[model samples]
Target: MEDIVFLYRLVPGHVHHSYGLHCALLAGVPDEIIKRAEVVLDAVSKNNCVERLCNENISAQDDEYKNAMEKLLTFDIDSGDLNLFFEEIFSSS
Candidate 1:
């Protein structure tokens, strides 16, 4: 859970919220992590979903969010695989 929060802070804002949600889901995190992820997801959805925006813009953002999620899911953290995840994230940044 703390790792999730650290990862969330490590990523850029565009992908930060979704990163934590995806990581928590992929890692099969505990209830507390799931709850936190949901809050972040809800806030992000609300902020991104603008009523007057063009469809293309919305679609692009959705695509980017999905891509970010997929990227996070690529790392297998099933057995508490934090080192590789952290290494990948830090190296990439």
Candidate 2:
């Protein structure tokens, strides 16, 4: 993870232990939830009960939120679509 960096939006690209937290922040997740995620991330990164902790925490989320997240994760855009989308966006800029 130290050798890898995500490029886009954030300046100077920083490495993250949990990119999902970055995505959650970008998606406007509540500050409290983000903080809680940070705690869980810290625990897991330190080799604490990773799987059990994750399952216990995530399983507490409501079904509606889970379904919505599942739908959001199902996006299947290919490179061509991405190029076209970016062209459409930057062309006007």
Best by lDDT: 2
- Clash pairs detected, candidate 2: none
Local distance difference test, per candidate?
0.62, 0.63
Off by over 4 Å in 1: 1-54, 78-93
User: Candidate 1 clashing pairs?
Assistant: none
lDDT score for residue 18 of model 2:
44
Best by TM-score: 2
Please write out the lDDT profile of model 2 over residues 50-90, one tens digit for every residue: 44445645665555466555544664565346566545444
